[model samples]
Target chain A: MSPRSDTPSSPSIDESRRGLDLGSDRRFLAALILLGGTYVSLLLAMVAADLFYTTPGHLWHALGSPEIRYAIRLSLLSCTLTTLLSLWVAVPIGYLMARFEFPGRAFLDALLDIPIVLPPLVIGLSLLILFQTAPLRALETVFPVTYAVPSVILAQFMVACAFAVRTLRTTFAQINPRQEQVAMTLGCNRAQAFWRVVLPAARPGILTAATLAWARALGEFGPILVFSGATRMKTEVLPTTVFLELSVGRLEAAVAVSLLMMGSAVVALLLVRTWSGTGLAGVSSLRNG
Target chain B: MISLRHITIQAGSFNLRDLSMEIPTGSHTALMGRTGSGKTTLLEGICGLRSIRSGSIWIGDREVTNLPPGQRGIGLVPQDGALFDHLTVRQHLEFALEVRGWALERRETRSQELAEWLGLTSLMDRLPAGMSGGERQRVALGRALAFHPPVLCLDEPLSALDDQTRGEIVAVLTEIRNRTGITILHITHNRSEAERLADRILHLRDGRLES
Candidate 1:
């Protein structure tokens, strides 16, 4: 065969092969992109449809109603209390699980997940049963927690604490234990090192845990409904408000409550993202040192 | 004086077996070892960060093998400084003094003294993230010296610095040794560094010390 003829055919063949490869790669990538985008669009469409279901005037009226107002106030106070309590429990438990070796560490770690994996209704029912026990019942005489304002906070904290613990555990695990070791060598006891060094360094994780716990508490309904009874203006939070409105055939009010919760969750998540993003850079750079 | 008597420590897969040595008070002793030779393990064992399988660590007149790291009174400058990310250099130096229950006025004076000695007076306001490697090491050194422990342990302190920075740190170490006359157990891989900073050299191979 002539060299020129062979060269021309080979170049054309290689070009065609390259085109085929690029075409197939583009098709595969496009299909995956479309599939992922469609899944996200499905969620967006559901939220958007629910948001616009009622007229703007109707939503405003529902939001301004006395019942909705009570729910909003109750939701904010209970969620904030729940977040604070969750962090109190999360920090110690997270540090214990991350830094110490104990006989029951794995068991305790797994037990922490029960709240996350269990049905919300079960958690509520469990709390209800727990208060009925002789000791808790005696303590209830002094501090009435069940079916009261305190019940709302307790229920939210039960689930929120689990999530917070998980977040903070991962945070502590990511930190170098050498920092604590060095601190100890520099004359700090274990508690001092944890407070001055580890806790401050884990600020991003703490913020993330608090945000997640707050969001979870804000949306918590099943536990509140079962344990706290969701009485009007008493134990009613935002999620329970939706249920209460739907029971009373107030469709617009229920949709408006759902929209309010969605808005709050979005805003809270955005704030957390901004805070953690800036805070993490400082932490990572310090860790690098 | 610092002494390890029949020290046997097991850390992960590495075991420091029956290793014993003594550094006289005010002597700078270098422990030279290759990577994975358990130099850090040995250092941490002496610092009480790692529990020994069987041994006793003595700092000055006290047997610190059973004591916690904080009560052992041995200061450690870990590899890469390991400075607190959230604390400024001044705070880093003041931490040990505060923990030791020094009065606020005394802590301030000691911090100022350490800053001047380490050439960190101007950088005291900056956090470790903004400092160069050499600066971080200097801060670590100052922090380790803040409590005035009779013995100090340095783990690969100069390994992360450039040649110029390393020289500066070695000079600082020499000055510190001269002024305070504190016992130093420095771990390094470089022979020249050991020779420069240490009055006595001990080689570690396969986790066993060979003087």
Candidate 2:
């Protein structure tokens, strides 16, 4: 009888198993693609529906409205201001949170995140209540805060600043503390090291934080609705424009304004990527040494 | 001179108790230790980067026990250089001088001299990311030495380079020692390196020092 041929070469066994593994991998990948493709198709369908629902004529008419024009101008100005103010506050708070170990630091960290986790309308209500208090209420007589133009910016800032602070904190945390320590050893004082070494390293992160704040401020609705009251040509931002148009039963105009807001958001996100050449949220990526 | 008298440092649950050491001026001493022997902790304590629970640290006859890192007048080259990524080599060399409020002309002159001495004159405008391991290490050394502090501390500065680059850096280090009488506290685990560069060797095991 021939030598037992049941135990073939080990290489043939491995080759057959390898072929089976390849088939299994293909099936696994196919399942992943099928699941992921469904979500992507849903997103595409939503965008397609938004485009198909409104015409260029409606968009042009919405743009032609003097009230909408004024809303656009005010939205731009307030969002820019909110972004600048948010950065000014965020950088120092972020640095302290990232670098220091003080008493009640964990408590403070959690407390700072309240704006992020709180219900949107509650923030606006809280602001309204805050302005009604003694000192602010006294000041309100001289400088009106509640239900005013400043109230619009203030409401946007309440939510936008929390986002800016979170971004900046992560940015500062990613940077190596060694460079700051080395700077001190090389004759830089604490403040100088932060300004020269830490700040420069965090420049990309600052830009990202500012972009996030601007975007958040632009889309802010519930706070502005409750705090500033969406008066046409007074406190109407893009989101409020959509709300006001829908309230008047002009679905076409509401869709038009929503499309415009979407366009602006896309442009802003593109600009960030174009300017930094880093993908979204490249916080502390540029000078990570 | 660099002196540590009865120093006890507590890092987490590990304790380095009553460790004492002395290095004379213009001498190179190597510190040898196992992976977790607290060599870096002791080095940080000397440089004022970490707190020591007890005892005193003195540098060049002046007690720097409570001084801040910048006020200590000691230069430290941490592992792998720790060079600033955003700055060019020239900027790094003049960093200390610039921070101390030196005039533009003076800073330029000193940085130029240092660049030439470190064989990095051609690479002045390059950032740390664009350089070789040896070149970056040279820049690090030049940066630390630019301000001319009395003491220089090296924390495994040569361990990251290849064999030939290591040899080149060793030669450069030997020259640096001969030219300037700066006290150097070199940290290394390699016995051959310790024998080659250090005048005296000190070993650390379980946070205690042995000659």
Candidate 3:
């Protein structure tokens, strides 16, 4: 008898046994089918139509109205303000989380994430309560904050800031802190190092956060309605106009406003893509190097 | 002169304890050790990047123990030539000069001189990521040296290059030192490169200087 064989004779079987899972073809096929069936572009189109379509005549009338122009301007202005403010707040917070050792840092990080997970409506309600109640209410009386333009801004600021902080913290974490230290050793003081090295290096990531915050603020409805009461011409934004039109059964006006909102979202995305291309390319290369 | 007295640095688990050493002005010292030796830690301590738990450090007459890195007047070319990939070769040198408050005229002149000296005149406009390992290392060295630092620290400067490229860099480094007379603290695990460049050698193991 031949010596008892220990190794399999078929090289294909042995090679396949090394790195291949043998029984997941069906599951893999199922995943691909599910992915194809739930493709995102189709879903976006369906949701966009449902959210935006009302009556064509009202839609056209709303588009031509001067009030719509004011709404658009105010919406863009407020969202821009919210984005800039969010970035201003997020950078230091993100860098601290990335590069420092401190007390209660983990707790603070967890707390920052809470707003992102909570419904925007809930956050709005909570802010309203805090501003209306005692202690906080007393503080607010010294600085009033409910159902005003500032309230709308405040609500946008809160949610936008939360999104920015979370995104930026992750961005900063992905960078090596050694780069800043190296910059310092090259005779740059802390601020100089941050400006010259850290900020430039973190630009792409920061831009990403800003883009997200701005878009989120632009599309915000739940928070603004609850906090600022959706007053016409004072705190009414694009989303609120759509909401108002829908509630009043002005179907075409609602659709038109929705289309405008959708158009702006597209424009925002395009601007982000174009603006971040070169900066992110440089950053990604540096990261790889 | 760079001096460390009773320096100790604590990370999560490894502790570099009571490490005392000195690199005199205009003197080249090579730090040689096995893996895990505190050679890089000592360099960072000298540069004031890592905090010293218990020690006094002086770069020349300035007490740099607690000072920030920029105030220490030190330049470090880290391992694998950690050049900013987004910056061009000329920009790398200019950045150092700019940070040190060099005048515009002096910045241009110094960058030109360094680029020519490093054989980087042909590649000044190219970004670091597009450069070869040797080219990147050369740019990094130039960036560090452009500030005219009294002392320069290098960590495994030639370890990432091929044999031919390593030879070329060693030649350039030797020429740069001969002309500038800048003090060099070179850290490497390679005995051969250390022997080629070092005027004096410090053999360290587990954060302690070995005889």
Candidate 4:
């Protein structure tokens, strides 16, 4: 080909390529949208189905029911308690696991994962058996645990805490270790450095761990069912309320309860997201004071 | 005076074996070494961040070999200026005093003095994340110097800076050295930094000092 005839200006070449690029880009976008949209659509569809099946009246009626009201109160109480307890146990374990290297560290790490990997029902069964041991049996006489309110919190904590610990371990690991070292050199002892430097820096992670623990505790069913049992106005929680309603062929009640739990979850998530976004509202006072 | 007598530091598989050196009081020294030459391990041993396997570390006349880092009366400015992200410049300067149980009024005065000295008075309320590299480095220096420790250890402190910023920091460091008369052990790869700031320079090759 002749150079003048065959060769084109760079702008002309870019213009031609732009035409093809637009079509390809549109197709690529469509494929990605379809793939991601499919999963989101499924979720939307299920939620829509729940909305379609239950009315405002059904939610009100479920709320009016004495059993569900008890379930709501109990669920709120136990989930908060479970979250508090989980954070207490998880933070120390997470810090130690992330910051130190010792003999049997690997073994201890594997042991923590057993709750996450084990079947929930097995955890419930294990707890039931644990309570039967001589020491726990002796303590049981002082306070009833199995098939009681305490059992509800215990069951939720067993699984929820493992999740909290895992999240916190990752959270603490991501923070700079140099900060703590610097703190120690600044005349703060090891514990003081952790309290002031390490913990304050790990605010986001603590929020995440607490949220995960709360959410996991809210949805827990298998362990609660196995150990606490579904009783009316006593050991009954929201999950059990759903199970009891469904077993008795009250689909509307179950659906209403489900929506209630979903709303609570959304509210909890939003609260945390807002709190975290706001820099935890006076970090300087907390850290320096 | 600071002294390390027959010190040994074991860092995993690498070891700085039986090294010994002396840093006279009120003198700033620069230590230079090739990569992976155990400069950091040796620095950590002196600051009590890492425990020495054998031998003694003495600050003045007291044997401080067994003391914790907090009790050793030393200050550290690691590379990258590890300032706490959640604290403001004022908080950073006041941290050591706060932890040491200084009264609130005393801490405020000390932080104000440091802010004036380091030219950080304009950044008192600003968090570390909002600061420039040079600014953060200055804050780190203020934090190290806040409690007025007798010894200061700098680990590759000026390696992460542009030339102009480096020059400014070098000037600030020189001012600090002259004014405070505190002993400093600065680790760096830049010969000019050593020439410009240090009273004496030492080199580390294969874990032993070459004066």
TM-score against native, each model: 0.88, 0.90, 0.87, 0.91
Deviation of model 3 at A241, angstroms: 1.5
Lowest lDDT block of 10, candidate 3 chain A: A1-10
Q: State interface RMSD in Å for all models.
A: 1.4, 3.0, 2.1, 6.1
Q: Which lDDT value does model 2 have at A58? A: 95
Q: Which stretches of candidate 3 lie over 4 Å from their true place?
A: A1-30, A39-59, A134-144, A270-280, B60-62
Give residue A40's error in model 1 in angstroms.
2.7
Query: Which residue pairs show collisions in model 4?
Result: none
- Return the DockQ of model 4: 0.38
Docking quality tier of model 1: medium
Per-residue lDDT tens digits of candidate 2, residues A220-241? Answer: 9998999999888888888998
* Cα error, candidate 2, residue B108 (Å): 1.8
Order the candidate numbers by DockQ, best to worst. Answer: 1, 3, 2, 4
Q: How well does candidate 3 score on lDDT at residue A41?
A: 67
Question: lDDT (0-100) at residue A10 of candidate 3?
Answer: 27
Where does candidate 1 clash, by residue pair? none
Task: Report per-candidate DockQ.
Answer: 0.54, 0.41, 0.44, 0.38
Model 1 lDDT on a 0 to 1 scale:
0.86
Model 3 DockQ (Cα-based): 0.44
The count of backbone overlaps in candidate 3 is: 3
Model 2: pairs clashing at backbone N, Cα or C within 3 Å: none
Encode model 3's per-residue lDDT on A222-252: one tens digit a residue.
8899998978888888998888877888777
The better candidate by TM-score, 3 or 4, is 4
lDDT of 1 by residue, A1-289 (tens): 0001000111222234433244648888788779999999998998989977978888889878998899899999999999999999999888777777767677998999999999999999999999999999999999999989999999999999999999898678667788888888877777888888889989888998999999999999888888899799889889988998899898988998888889899988997787666555654665556
